[model samples]
Target: MARLDRGSVSGAACGPDMPAIEVRSLSFAYPGADAAVLEGLDWSVPQGAFELLVGGTGSGKSTLLSLLKPEIAPAGERTGDARVLGENVADMDVRASAERVGYVFQDPENQIVCETVWHEMAFGLENLGVSRDEMRRRVAETSYFFGLEDWLHRDTDTLSGGRKQLLSLAAVLALRPRVLLLDEPTSQLDPVAEKNFLHALFRVNRELGCTVVVATHQPRPMLEYATRAYRIEGGCICKVADIASLGHREELFSGEVSGWGASRRAKNGVFSSASGQLDSLGPRGGAPGAKKGLKSGKSAEFEVQILSQDDSGVPSRVGGGRILQKMHGGSATTLSEGWFRYDRAAGWVLRGLDVTFSAGAVHAIVGGNGCGKSTMLSVLAKTAKLQRGRMVRGAASAALLPQNPKALLVAETVRGELMEWASTCGYDEDAAQERAAQLGLDGLDARHPYDLSGGQRQLLALAKLLLIGPELLLLDEPTKGLDLANRRIIARALCEHAQAGGTVIMATHDLDFAEQVADDIAMMFDGEIACMEPPTDFFADNVFYRA
Candidate 1:
């Protein structure tokens, strides 16, 4: 939260109809790059409009967002005129620009600097030299509006991922910036939390008149609230249109089908709600061998069944071999009455959790934030000791990828990092390169690992772990900042791993992804696993846990 010290530019008076942001013939490249990441890009955001920026991984969405602020503008050759609130961003003072243009990073932890929630909210105002009374008043108002009153006195480290992200937004909003720039703010949140956070952003735009520009891979949830939408490709703006004219609003809710007896049809592997009779006896319907009119015990609710077929109307086996082959005979890890906690004074994170992971299978753990999903993964990965439970390990070794992928990144270049892991695992350079290409890191071998985008960094970390050839792979939020295309790549890779007799256990808030790849879905709640069943049964039966 240290204030940047670049010199300031005098504020320019803007008319009511002027755009909040305007860019013309902007081109930028990093210090050592051969070509510009953004080339001849021109864009504008209408005043008070909620703008959504959608693009694939490494598509310059982040680069464009960075150029909007003076303090964080990338170091490189630049040619263009970028203006914010009628003032040229290149000439604006750091402090003044920050006051009118608030930026929130993808990772909430990165933006937070103070220990407690209250202090974090006050940090930005303090940097702006606001009076003590005024700071207190603004902090109180912002916190209350964001619903942080209950946790105001609590330590920030103790809050859940969702709360931490909300706290970051509240802190930025306390400055009362005229425009807010968010980079994948909801990528780490659960479905419910993500929805709530987007609604809060809508309120900020509608009620406070703060123009918003969000760059996200998951744009379906925010489309309804967006006034305009733009798609970036090949370092340029490819499509721009009003949100209402997008003609695919219903498709946005395709992945969120939760109510009992509710049936949904899958389109190109994405799920959406169905209002008519459920199809239970066809290739596009329920489980094979299931009755035509399957219903739940209490009511006529149809049993949740995911149709297994590719887009071409043909049965397709996603995994190499038979699905769920390991569930019958293979067991990688078993936790019996497992219980864990950080300290004796703190409440237990995992309470009597009993679950078994099968080899040659992908298991997904889904739950609300702070419900012990990560803690369970740590226990299974042997990073955390099981205090009061019997544990059985079936695998010889396991590789744990923490939620923050940056933790495992230390090498100067991406290739060096992978090669280091390869050397440890007795792998050759060819094998390393092959794996890197599979994960879409083919041409980034010589680039600095820190310089890659967040999604790229996540993929590199995964590639490093894959080179080790561990018996068990543990991933936490593998798809946090990845676009849909990148997510598909990871999903296919995990499926191939399972086919090769390896165990894969991932804890994610992405329920759509869980349905797409998981053989078994486990729900954790109140420090204990509440249920474990097939993807179809797990999502259809549980109302709240269904994403």
Candidate 2:
């Protein structure tokens, strides 16, 4: 777990002046694609430095990161020289590359190779034919370093998204790679979990002397520690003169009028309130008048409590379009005294919870990681049955977009995924392409579903669900990996869904998205709904849950 003493790991010269990663004239195009995603790029990273890559969805950030680790690099017509720790990426020895270069996938679950935490940590080492004693030492050291000792024996599936991601980082560090590459590592994490993970990653770069490179749309959290930054634009990588300038480029991710009544600023990517909105959380399980309005804050005035950004007045909806038809306003579904747990031996996830979702509103479940938000969605989706609760649904049709959007993707081609459910969803190929265009996925019909950026893939999955014309829509982390522009697109889509008399219940860690799009916001804490209210009333006077 310790590699801090390396003079240099790049090139033949073991000197501090050497670069850990270097790229020259790198151009790549996926098979059967229209053009190259990356073209004629030249870049370099200092040894043992922390670096960041900034780009929007489908902008080739993922492709650039993939090229760093040649073993799993995507299939394509590639022309370039990419070197990691002094060795050409394309010509790396299989064993040597696996030991020297570490890559963490955007989806934490995508890279996990074992059922249990212990096995996963050892899996990579086992492949390298590491000595038994050395593997045990590394495992124990890393487990303690990442605070994973508590769940060493737990099944990987039992861990929350945050925990799984942390474990992934720990497992990779167990190999003591000279350089680490992470793609949107904190996309699924809650605020608190993200801070913790960043701290750990920082230690790897500072204390352990491992070169770190991360690609992310959300760069605020990593800006403080980044030694350099590169942005991919028009199939080329451009070095940024001042990394701090990225924080001020609000237009990069957040400049569209929200579909809902309010606006969300993606600059800070954290929620905190100077106003005392906690007082409005009346009573116990929920705020007063919780059920009075399906669209909670159509007329109420709420003060903004910003941590860094200015209190710009609320924005207005620009486009007025409807994707769904309005149905009779009534209860979409009701969960009465819901009680559920994944395993009888495991702790209860939903404890005697009761709530009603109206037919024409966007309701968001906001909470910390591992607070049973996703589980509640599963119970509602019927993917996970509640042990002792009644789910009464008035709507005949419904659809679910899971936390991991790739779960529902069953087809090899992007067009095929849309066509797979065209018959069942009451939509044809043209409608499918139209829906895809609405979510910024129009030109990717020929690519495989797995090849898209994390955010693009999310939109594709959501397009499938929306095409179903479901009256009851369930989404988990609906905007997990999206940039602000895509977030705006999705916000409008949810607005259309609600405007059409459909009901949406989504679990998310993005409070900004919730503030701008959600009509009703519910705070889930420790297997219970701690409070529920409109965005104005919910975030106003609130002291925590913000950065």
Candidate 3:
């Protein structure tokens, strides 16, 4: 159904007993931009609606959410009025609105302000002047609920990405806001951790009736729970009467609700199944085999290894455990070796390890929350040394795209930056520009690195590394903050690069993304590789193979 226009909505009139949030004709545009992000958008949530907003990236879902809490709205935008809890957002003060609205940013790093989990959780209550004793109680309560009591004192930097996101939530929940806005809160989490977080969210909604609104490209987890599902397009919102009727049942499991060949309506009498769509749900596809023969099972795989760079700058004397696996190609990759711990207090975090990645293939790693997937990726990237057994390999060129690519960008113009990296790679300016265009950065030569969105920044960072032509690329949770169009733009570029015979390794919670683009699949649990196989087999049956 098409959505209403902003001019059609009114602020002075919501019927009595209206939902916690009501938007009518809420239109807005970003600063210095003539185009409006939202036009004639209208949506309303009763006192306790669990609303789920689903759309591709840059579809104006985030922009709509920002309107609910005006403090976060971008500057230089004209907005039709939106009322939250009987108060017009434009008229309300920012701080007071913050206290009443709990918003969790998509990037945990952006929202995290404290050094430790305990302090971070308590910061909100402290600002509200909740007594010290009360703050302590709230902290303890939230920690216990989110399973963070043991790591309460742990440094925020030391926490894994999933854990860091969990901490972000606990901190926001500590504020006990009347309305909760989660912006892709589960993008970094593994399966288990995501389930736990959702359980907590539902509990809060059920018990406290804290009106919940979440914007996400992935909707399976919230399918049965969300009171209403709304789709955003052209900066407008429309009520979706029945999501099941959309004919994308697979979306209820994997988030591949949108994609090429994926959005095909149930037409032409074609039947679909797990392996791939078919005329009939039969075994003809045989669940496409993995690149490295890793099988599937319910439990995750775990392997471990440790090695050090010798005096000759070569990987020498691998001594950790059995985490190393040599694929058909010459390259060797690391899988988790059961959960490893540096101290007794840290306990075991990784479990069974099994992952098989071909040297020249594009593989994606994903799992539920707190599943030690990022830790394994860090090990692969050689960023976090393992105390038990770090996966060590012979000298191989590797480039990693951290969750935030902005951290690595340090150039004035895209052209200058690529030129700098080209010099390092012994390439000339013309060569660098050629590579930049291939990556889809046309006419962006003079653009400041900081001006790019998360996706564009990532592409630029990748361009810099590609100039050197690294043999292996390790991308840690690359699509966390990207919109669908941006995500597709990056994915297509990576696919082209892979076709050119480079090995691409991506760790993400986007399962559908893996299914669509990965040549091989790896699933991590605890600190081990649970399964590694082809996308088809991994999703249908979780299994990892050993070489």
After superposition, candidate 1 runs with Cα above 4 Å error: 1-10, 242-329, 544-547
Best-fitting candidate, scored by TM-score: 2
Candidate 3 error regions (>4 Å): 1-16, 245-330, 333-357, 368-371, 386-396, 410-468, 482-491, 543-547
Better of 1 and 3 by TM-score: 1
Best by lDDT: 2
Each prediction's Cα RMSD? 9.6, 9.8, 11.9
For residues 425-487, what per-residue lDDT tens digits would candidate 3 score against the true structure? 565665566556655577667667654434556677877876665667778787775655556
Q: Can you write out model 2's per-residue Cα lDDT over 466-545, one digit (the tens) per residue?
A: 77777889998888778777876776667656654678899887777777678778888888898988787888857766
**Residue 346 miss distance in model 1 (angstroms):** 2.3
Better of 2 and 3 by lDDT: 2
My TM-score estimates for the predictions, one after another, are 0.82, 0.85, 0.72
Q: What is the lDDT of candidate 3?
A: 0.63
Q: What ordering of candidates by TM-score runs from best to worst?
A: 2, 1, 3
lDDT of model number 1: 0.75
Task: Please give the CA lDDT of all the candidate structures.
Answer: 0.75, 0.76, 0.63
